[model samples]
Target: MSGTELMEKPAAPAKLGRAIPPAFQGKQFPLLAVIVFLALFPPLIQSDAYDLGLLNNVLIYSLLTLGFYWCFALAGQFTFAVFGMYAVGAYVSVWAARHLGGFWSGLVAAVVVTAAIGALTKLAFARCSEIYFAIATMALGSLIVILFREWTSFTGGYEGVSDIAVPSIFGYQLISGQSKYYLGLGILAVLLLLTVLFFRSPVARDLAFARDKGPVAAVTGLKPVRLQLMGFAVGSGIQGAAGSLYAHGSGFFSVEAFNIDLSLLVLLMLLLGGMVSMYGAIIGAVILVYLPEFLRDASKYAEVIYALAILVIIVAFPRGIAGLRHTLGRLVRRA
Candidate 1:
């Protein structure tokens, strides 16, 4: 072919050519190691129902991360309402299940109701920008918590609602703390898979696009208001689902459990784990959840330490677990 023709046509490859994306290369060993360690965790710990119960609490927080991951990580929308939604879901489900005579219906109702509440709130705040969104959610959450706390007759005041039922999936009920731990672990696995897969879809891309500025999103022919609404509603729904699980798991529900502190804890989970990376959420969940256990008699102090660690990590290693790994790699090289 002539030079012009050859250049225009494109050159042929050799006899064989192959392409592989190394970014998707296997990290099977690291994953396997993590799984093995977690699987052996109960054995390494006290193994009694009390300690296992505490660990189950950690798993519940992990589930909370899975919910916040949608709003905090994927969509970059921060809401202080997540824990409120979580409480709403838990109590609603328990109450519904007890009254409705089945756990299935309660679970469905919990999510639906929480979503409705979240949708209304998001629509109300759709006009606001980022900091405003957080402030609005915080204010709404505080209001909700107060309602639950002061609406004594219904929510049982500071004492919480007790004797609530634990859930049974396909007739296999969680009879003990260890059993509940395994069940929570299973549900968590399902949620992780769904979030990771969902992250690659157009829906996720649309949400991310809309997060920058509402006007920009409007100009792009995207409904920023509606997108934020959907994310807020869905994220709240997930929190509710986690709440449902927690209510049954703990056999109780209280305003204190799902108050603003829990909201900050969720945020910490996002930051410590690196909100952009799914692994970051999981890492943050594990650290924050277990740190209290290691604290023993002075767990409140451990929380202070955890907060300090989070600030340091955010300032020094914004990339999360992946970032820390990169830093360690450089240090190893220098050494």
Candidate 2:
């Protein structure tokens, strides 16, 4: 073929066959399926308030873990400020709701304030090494926890803030366990959808490049610092939202709820689930949350067994449970 003709020629059509829809491709189908299951779950166990509460916890922790995934996993920013952001979000939401006269206002205030704080924190430590940045954020988080503990007039000290306003929509209060569970599930579904979209977008690719090849990315016109700052802000904002959800749903919370232990537990969840996988965050949160309950009968051995189980999982599947599928597929192909 002539050069110009070849350049202008349309590609030959392939044989016609069924094509998978975009929604069913990659991880989208599985995410949709999970959402569907969660949507139906409340009706299946509506009578069990305890189980519903546990489900709510799963949803909440999933959000928190996803935030960690965004910052540490996606953007390569090691930060221990998750719980601090969570506490700030919760307290801010409560304060806003009391003064601003609505749950929506409080939630908005939480997300905005935490996002700003997150961005500022990143900017302030923009030049620090990863380890130092982590240390700085951790110290700041601990300081926040201490502030909340000592601020009796604000956080209610050790007693925590009580009589938190119930979250409502259009005059309808989410008073029942089922209602609260569905609310959390809906928020999670929306965020998961956004995350999926983000994963498919060019921005995610650029962020990944920046994270894995910082100096090279900067040399090639990618703004690594800006990307990391945005990631940190968004991630922190998500944590803040989770915190607001927790405060409103529980109607009471203390600084103890957002201590350093909570931050470490979240980090463990992220590590155990597979840092790079968004689904891993959800899987990790669910497993870790339920594992303790399952081992409740073990009593004295529970802690030991828990530690052993985590160690085995980490050692055997370093990439996490979500990565297990990929390993299995590789083995199948090799076989």
Candidate 3:
């Protein structure tokens, strides 16, 4: 080939670039693959208990991530009482299951209690903007943790309540990691599907409307008040259910399980992931949970690493991982 022609051809493709995804490209296949891989990973690492535990931790964090997204991404909520609601679920589940006879009853009790707490929080702080709401909720979170630690009879103090029963389906025991993984995955799948359907509904759109009261009130035909309350109640119930499932899966409950650290992590996960995508919540949860394992004992510096990762993603890839793929696809098409 002629040197001039070859040089021009090479640069031409670079200038043309790759095609990008459309504004509404569906992401079912790729996301489904990710979910399947995660489900299978633990069994492949069969000999390592730590890896299994890490996987489980990611699954739990995914639930937290989804709850955060439901409040923040879908509803435009800046509430900080996630862990508080979660704690209520754990403690209430423990008490209810022990006193109320069955697992179903305990789960129902946890959801009812946590939903009430979450609704009350929204009623009190729904008017507050970001900073004040966060601070207030942060303070409330510490109080919940402290109260749980101090109330020995109810929360079992710092030692925590242990030996919780694993969840059963149709009178069958689910004691293994594999069993638990599928259970957690089933819950996550249901929630994600519901979230997707809700996003398509007018109710979900109303909640995430621009914060300018006049604009939102004027433009949107949907009932903002009812929608916002529904988002809070439903999101909070997921967190409650997640906590109940977690307590049983992990077989314990403690102050540390629902502390301020957990709160911060959940917030970061929501931020780090594409807040708009439920799958992004799951990805962020998995990465945050398993990053420590990849680092081994050096994970003591995980807080630092995690912070840097968040900054890099926010600064360099503003759309987040899930959104980045779509963004790149669009850019390619635009080019």
Residue 3 Cα positional deviation in candidate 2, in Å, after optimal superposition? 42
lDDT of candidate 3 vs native? Answer: 0.69
The candidate maximizing lDDT is 2
lDDT of 2 at 309: 97
lDDT digits (tens) for residues 102-141 of candidate 3: 5667778888887777667767886787689778877876
Predictions ranked by TM-score, top down? Answer: 2, 3, 1
Work out candidate 3's RMSD over C-alphas. Answer: 9.0
CA displacement after TM-score superposition, residue 6 of candidate 1 (Å): 37
Ranking by lDDT: 2, 1, 3
Candidate 1 at 203: error in angstroms? 1.9
Candidate 1's TM-score reads 0.80
Q: State which candidate, 2 or 3, has the greater TM-score.
A: 2
- For candidate 1, lDDT tens digit of each residue in 186-208? 76666665554454345655666
* lDDT of model 2, residue 165: 87
Local lDDT at 313 for model 3:
84
TM-score against native, each model: 0.80, 0.89, 0.81
Report the C-alpha lDDT of model 2 over 270-302, residue by residue, as the tens digit.
878876467777788889989999999988899
